[model samples]
Target: MSDHAPESGPRRRLRLRTLLLALPLAGLLLSLLLVLPLRWLAPVTSAFMIAVRLDDEAGRWPEYRWVPYEAISAQLALAVLAGEDQRFAEHHGFDTVEIERALSAADQGSKLRGASTISQQVAKNLFLWSGRSYVRKALEAWFTLLIEACWSKRRILEMHLNLAQYGPRTFGAEAAAQRFFGKPAWDLDAGEAARLAAVLPNPRLYRVEAPNATVRTRERHIRTQMRNLGGTGFLDRLSE
Candidate 1:
């Protein structure tokens, strides 16, 4: 019983409510701080690469060599767009059509296929861990929005090319090019680019070094999609 009165219940509740309300805004501001600089500065490493390095199951160091967008071949970029997200240039960050289709499939008692857009994948690979948890998905969504708002479509795809896993040990187009094709990423032709993009679904299982029947089929499909997308001209949309 000092002169000061004890804290009132209503005031304590109001304080708690205010703190809870401010938390998400604070988190968003912090995320903006993290993503805005990446528009100009290329990431040195990604969360996925770090996870791979720390993984006990992964015996060796991952192969990741950063290459600027110019250093990577346009063929490879087009191939990735063809294989991963066909509507990449059209969408902002999320692909509503793909998500709706996936949800419809699940409602029909079919398996839910992955519907992540390139922007979402860039967010996940660059910033988050692998999981289906609501928290992870929420964070991914937040980062996806931040990235789309902060970086250009070109920067998003550039990050994807550098961060995506191409092989068990390979972590970028440059590494995949040097390891599999024995050439620099800049020299990769369409066929080579398509092959590399084909194994992206499950890189650890699908070998780019030795194309399985599935890999070959996907490679052919990607090449067809590339042609359907009007060849490398589709990539020009990234700048706009």
Candidate 2:
């Protein structure tokens, strides 16, 4: 008869250490690899836009244009930052204060609002799919850290402005500006930019050209936030 014995302390500890080290090492490699490509690669499209197109052929294909960061009106960028992420310039990748508030709110049975920062949104839009899966969120966090580490904050903001969905078939500031205001993105004024930012929360439900009462309210809120964030000064430190 053969007898089997459970592994003892030293061997078990060694195995544990290997596993602990392996996870972080693997994460480091993934981040480093992604960082290098992102430094020079301006992605023409994103996973979210592709996903939306695949499921719905009811509308025209989304309009998308890649404009340099400078080509976009600073107001539009500021509106989006104000509307979606006020702490965008301050936070590295995650916003723990908002995260904690969301958690506390959830625990209290309050309405759940997403606390995804702009960087996290960019990570999700560029590299991952939409939805509220913990698995997807974990991957998003990994990619967010990589993006924050590898790219300038301006690059992150610019990429986000060009990729986030503005309507059912509208992608990017340029497309949304043209579609809604009949002007290029660079020409977007404060009200136009605020309206666009208003639709960002739920583009399908809000129309920029014909905003509903709710959307109008949101637009007002975004405009107020934009002023609070100090207009164009928000991007001061976001350069290379």
Question: For candidate 1, lDDT tens digit of each residue in 1-240?
Answer: 699898999999999999999998898888888899999897888898888888847466689999999999999999999999988888889999999999999999999999999899999999999979999999999899888888888999999999899997689999999999999999999999999999998998999989999999999999999999999988888862
Local distance difference test, per candidate?
0.92, 0.86
Residue range 1-240, candidate 2, lDDT tens digits? 659787999999999999999999987887687666877777867888888778786744568998988999999989988888888778999998999999999999998889999889898988788788889989999888888888888899989899988987789999988888899999999999999999887888888778899999999999888888778787675665
Candidate 1 — which residues are off by over 4 angstroms? 1-3, 56-60
State the local distance difference test value for candidate 1. 0.92
lDDT (Cα, 0-100) at 93 in candidate 2: 94
RMSD values for the candidates in order, in angstroms, are 1.7, 4.2
Q: Give the TM-score of candidate 1.
A: 0.94
Candidate 2 deviant stretches above 4 angstroms:
1-31, 58-61
Q: Provide the lDDT at 131 for model 2.
A: 80
